[model samples]
Target: MIPPEVPLDDEELVTRAQAGDLEAYELLVARHTASAYRTAILLGAGADAEDMVQEAFVKGYRKLSRYRGDASFRSWLLAIVANETRNLHRSRDRRTGLVLRAARAAPYSEAAEDGAVDAALAGERRATLVQALRSLPERDREVIVCRYFLDLSEDETVAMLGWARGTVKSRTSRALVKLRGLLDVEELSRG
Candidate 1:
């Protein structure tokens, strides 16, 4: 008896999804959900990040026929997530708090011996960075989050933002400058 072939790559899954394979589409959603959630959080969706990710996956699956297959499936999905997040933001009349929660500590770590001190310092730094990031204008924050927080490539950012390559580059540069200024001010205020 021959073993069933597994779809090893995103392209394979995407092709299957485009051909109306529900399992393939579900697998793609499982693979990309983390990234979608992270992008939603960075976009200030806050507690609604999970919902936005879910909605993005649903929208992507529904619009699968429109996918041109020029870019990676992850990029395409993230673009949907970004758009959903923006729509959520616009619909909410009140501003949602943008908070980057501290990462959970790993179990059975040597760092646990000094974890208290280390965690305090690390949390403080993370809080400061998150605060500075949240203070920037939405466009600047989006660029910074796409470039740094999400660790997306320039091309991916362009796809996600629906911006030209040159525009992504310029926006990223300007965003970084503004972020640095915000961080510097934060530092001076602390001292």
Candidate 2:
């Protein structure tokens, strides 16, 4: 069964999944499929995107026994999906051009996003924003995806990336600054 405090932090579910419990694995899929699909779509489009996500889940299932519980299962799965999607983008035969693709949705806008006030222009702005994200360096893009798209905190990002806290902080900050500059340029060109 899933936990009360944390939906995705069910140790029993994870153990069962690791032990080849198909039901438990299905529960995990039900819980995280939206995010996985969104991440895949952000990384690519069409059939290759779907294939990349399917491959990630398959890969995760195969390696479930190796899970050490050092990080949350969701974190581990996100890392796997991210890696698989990135690898899929890199494979020449796939020719998905995902490496130059952008996210499918914008980060949730709160009071902090006062600059993005154009509701009628949301979709186009978001597409433009996603395109800019695709142009960033791999490390920058990964940090952004992990931190924003996956809604993982800095510590979780560090765990996923195998980097120190300071390094994650520095890299994420630098990446956001670069992304902001890209957005500014995009905004200007649109004007």
Tens digit of lDDT per residue, candidate 2, span 1-191? 86577554557788988888899998987787777766666556435666777888888888989988888777677677777776766775454433234433335345424555564356566677668777787788778877886678886777667778898999999999999999999888878
lDDT of each: 0.81, 0.72
Clashes of 2: 0
Off by over 4 Å in 2: 1-9, 93-120, 188-191
Identify the candidate with maximal TM-score: 1
Whole-model lDDT, model 2: 0.72
TM-scores for all candidates: the values are 0.87, 0.75
**Which candidate number has the best lDDT?**
1
